[model samples]
Target: MLDRVITISREFGSGGRELGMKLSEKLEIPFYDKELISLTAQETNMSVTEFLNYYESIPVTEQSLEPPLYTSFSPLYEIPISDQVFLAQSRVIKSLAEKGPCIIVGRCADRVLEDSINLFIYAGIEHRIERIISLNKDLDPQLVENKIRETDRKRKDYYQYYTGCEWGKAQNYHLCLDSGLAGVEGCYQAVLSYLGHCI
Candidate 1:
């Protein structure tokens, strides 16, 4: 068994989620994706709807340039629901990491775990749109293209808002792969080969 957690950050419509699942199955380890939302909801006593509403989003508060200082906050004070949801998810992330090695995708997971294998997956816009359309046959291709760009923007903003780091930067990840180039299984094998060297 591997001794480290793997966190995957990817652009919308990238096959990163599928890649993460493949790795989890190959490694015989647990995987966290949408499952995180339910766990976080239970942890915070928030409804799943509420969790999904605030999941991986930046609240529109112009309070400060930095992430809220969890250290100085008073128990008596109330924080925004978005911030509260983020904090809850963070706690759930830490708790899961402490339990055992696993694969965590999205939700700025790369920055949450102290010791983890951080991976960033991206693809060309055309490739992304194609992938989405293939999976979602009822959706319009043009709308899929637009959603890809908009969702990526939101992801970038959320990552920057919480971590103060640029999302999808090569330097931030241990390994970066272009899913559009090699496809999902190819990327999975690449990750396996990379992991063979490290763990």
Candidate 2:
């Protein structure tokens, strides 16, 4: 049996990816984040750009289990592009979990992998904005804030559309950490400590 799998879902500007990478290194396990996009593209024989476009988008038809009051139609709708991408990625995630322990970041791995430790990482908007500004010092603060809001909105929509659950809801995850409060290193240590006790 696979010993342990950790899935992290994060707010757009949160340090979840950094924490995940650090935790993976500390635990000596493989890590999947942007790497998942490449793997899924290879598996589906689709271009990376195509996968990136539909990476976390949901089909309009799947906006709700029940029909919506109004529906917008698109050529891609017929192809179910988002569904195809998600299914391909889902297969890859399951395969990786079955192979052994690993850390998966984003792409809804928490929903794809059974018996995995699911963590939701979030930070206050002010903290997120500050982090983004620090990383991209040349960018305007307003632009950075707008970008963060848009990315987080897309992530939330994609996760909810696919999983039928609200993103960042504490109830949906095994643990919820405020990366803003703990910082990346502190959060990594906390996750390690939790894993040590649980697994």
Please give, for residues 73-169, the per-residue lDDT of candidate 2 as tens digits.
3432454767777777888998899888999999888977779999889999898989988888898888888998999998998887777778988
CA RMSD, predictions in order: 1.7, 4.7
> What tens-digit string does per-residue lDDT give for candidate 1 at 21-64?
99999999999998998898998786787667877777786664
In candidate 2, position 75 carries an lDDT of: 39
Q: How many backbone clashes does candidate 2 have?
A: 0
| lDDT (C-alpha, whole model) for all candidates | 0.85, 0.81
Q: CA lDDT of 109 in candidate 2?
A: 87
Off by over 4 Å in 1: 70-72
Q: Which ten residues in a row have the lowest lDDT in candidate 2?
A: 67-76
Error of 1 at 76 (Å): 6.9
TM-score of each: 0.94, 0.88
lDDT of 2: 0.81
lDDT of 1: 0.85
